[model samples]
Target: MQFETCHIPGLVIVTPKVFSDSRGFFFEAYNRKPFEEAGITANFVQDNQSQSSYGVIRGLHFQRNPFAQSKLVRVLQGTILDVGVDIREGSPTFGQHFSIELSAENKKQLFLPAGFAHGFSVLSETAIVAYKCDNYYSKESEGGIRYDDPELAIDWKIDPAKAIVSGKDLELPLLSESFANFTY
Candidate 1:
């Protein structure tokens, strides 16, 4: 496997070595040693999965400290435009965002450290997104920024009129209006 860090510190892209033939393909999805070598030492405690159709947007979400989660997300089927936004105060890339395409064909994965808000837009007819999180979810600690916040100016690649966002996500405050307490 090859682990590459993005411009934002602690965000990594993991590409597994796949051995494929006419039959199928095989690769190690997770291994403790290689991950530790790559500087990712989070002890994943929960796994979550979701399915969404084209135009569906889920997230721009994060948890406050003590309940902050580090996530390793991948597309199990179909494709999605994955996004991670840094909210860590005092960090060089704070408020900056990163976007990537994850698909079953490419088998790429993203590791988003704590202090980052995450979300994805489905690009295919349907997509299965799965992730491993280092911390358990806390409803009270849940917080997020609007997916279409202009200051961040994320291009979700889906038409605004076509976006299928949840009511709660639609109600999420914009970064400028947020009271998040993330730190560097």
Candidate 2:
């Protein structure tokens, strides 16, 4: 496995070496040793998966400090425009976001540390995304920033007219009004 850091600290892009034969291909998605060597020591405690149709946008969400989670996300099928935003207070990159295309073919993954908010938009007909989180989820600790926050100005790479977002997500606060629970 190879780990590449993004402009935002603690955010990493991971590429796994794949072996292919006449029948199929194989790669290790997560291995403790290599991850620790790469400076990602997240002890994942929960696994989550979701499936969405094209244009479906999921989030810009995070949990408060006590329930904060670091995640490793990858696509199991189809493709998506995955996004991560830096929200850690006092960090130089706070409010900036990073976007990447993840697909079954590319076999790439994004690792987002606890201080970031995460979201994705489906770019294919359908997509199945899976992720590992370092901490368990807490409903009371949940918080989010609006995906379309003008301050963040994230280009979800989808037509706004056709974008599908949940009412809950649409009601999330903007970056400036979001809950402050992280510090650099």
Q: Largest lDDT belongs to which candidate? A: 2
Q: For residues 63-158, what per-residue lDDT tens digits would candidate 2 score against the true structure?
A: 998999999999999999999999999999999999999999999999999999999999999999999999999999999999999999999999
Clashing pairs in 1: none
- Candidate 1 per-residue C-alpha lDDT over 11-103 given as tens digits, one digit per residue, 9 for 90 to 100: 999999999999999999888899999999999999999999999999899999789999999989999999999998888998899999999
For model 2, the run of ten residues with the poorest summed lDDT: 175-184
lDDT of 1 at 41: 99
Stretches of candidate 2 above 4 Å error?
A: none
- Give one clash count per candidate, in the order shown: 0, 0
The true-versus-predicted C-alpha distance at residue 82 of model 1, in Å, is: 0.5
lDDT value, residue 92 of candidate 2: 98
TM-score (C-alpha) between model 2 and the true structure: 0.99
- Provide TM-scores for the models: 0.98, 0.99
